[model samples]
Target: MVKDEYTLVLVKPDGVKTRHIGEIITRIERKGYKIEALKMIQPTEELLRQHYADKVDKPFFPELLEYMTEGPIVGIVVSGTNVIKAIHNMAGATNPVEAEWGTIRGDYGREWPDGNLRNIVHTSDEPSSATKEIKIWFPEFEFTQG
Candidate 1:
């Protein structure tokens, strides 16, 4: 049997509104990960507040909250070998201008009013983060033994 790893993925508001969901998922699947769980939901202020607690004190917090809650997004839990790093590479840098071609952000991101890249997707930066984020986004969706 093939051993697999897992990662958390977020098809951000822009990606969802732009109708890039299928393409993004296809890219991940083509990279060899399996979509273990997927859902579309509008995040609440409380959820965003907690999810981005690390950024709460930043000057961009308010706007970030506004942007995140503006529309529905797809939350996904994907699993495969070395999936965490693979997914991060697929997501690219937070700033689209700095991202290379073929990455999700590089292809679909836009410059925000604040001059930062409001990239169209998010992936956990590491395995620990993936575990934490997955739980936050999918509390009721349990991971079973493969």
Candidate 2:
């Protein structure tokens, strides 16, 4: 039997900077996804490092860190059938310029002349990623093992 899935969605610093939090949440609710928990966080370097452990060594990590820490980010725990993949598709491409028109990134994202890529949102790519990210962003929530 298929179990309902839970995933993490983050309105990145750019999303908050551009004031798209309400619209983003509205889209999630409009899709009939349950928002289990939500919080606004001023991300720290340590938390970001742990959240992005795989990318810490990448050349763009520093820039990413700067961008993420520039302002507050909204973390949302969403639950529904196949929500991980569904929300991922809803978030659109990593680059706003490449995203589809109906997706969140394409609608609210903006390009910076300084070449900083400020994609508006982040969603876990898969179940495992959701598990880990939810722990990072919503540590107080307990997971029920299936």
Candidate 3:
């Protein structure tokens, strides 16, 4: 049997504000991932800081925080075989302009007027990130590894 893996998927503020949550969720489900838990939240700057600790000092950090906290985001625990990679692929490149067609970013994300990173979804890029993010996004939810 294929052991199931889990990923933390978040449809960012822009996605919700633009009403792309349904389409994004539909794509995840269509790809065979299971959403074990989900919630909408207006994330804190502190949480964003911790989440992007490595990039917190970068110039774009403030913009990232402001953008992320702009509105409510839908966070989901997505599970399946190789879900981390699958979700990232679906999210496309960090810059929507470089993303391929059919990807979530390519399909709906648009470049900011100033060329900022306005890609819609934020999916964990690795197992480590997934583990950390799952905790931050769903602290009370319990998860079991297969």
Global lDDT of each model?
A: 0.86, 0.93, 0.89
Q: Candidate 2, after superposition: displacement of residue 139 in Å?
A: 0.9
Better of 1 and 2 by lDDT: 2
Of 2 and 3, the candidate ahead on TM-score is 2
Better of 1 and 3 by lDDT: 3
After superposing all C-alphas onto the true structure, candidate 2 shows an RMSD in angstroms of: 1.1
Task: State, as a TM-score between 0 and 1, how close model 2 is to the true structure.
Answer: 0.97
TM-score of each: 0.92, 0.97, 0.95
Best model number under TM-score:
2
lDDT of 2 by residue, 1-146 (tens): 78888999999998998889999999999999999899999999999998999999999999999999999999999999899999999999999999999999989886899788999999999999999999998899987643
lDDT of 3 by residue, 1-146 (tens): 77888899899998999999999989999998898998998899888888899999899898888889989999999999988998998899988889999999998898877656788999999999998998988988787877
In Å, residue 121's CA in model 1 sits off its true spot by 0.6
Q: Which pairs of residues collide in model 3? A: none
Which residue runs of candidate 2 sit more than 4 Å off their true CA positions? Answer: none
Candidate 1: Cα lDDT at 6? 76
Winning candidate number (lDDT)? 2
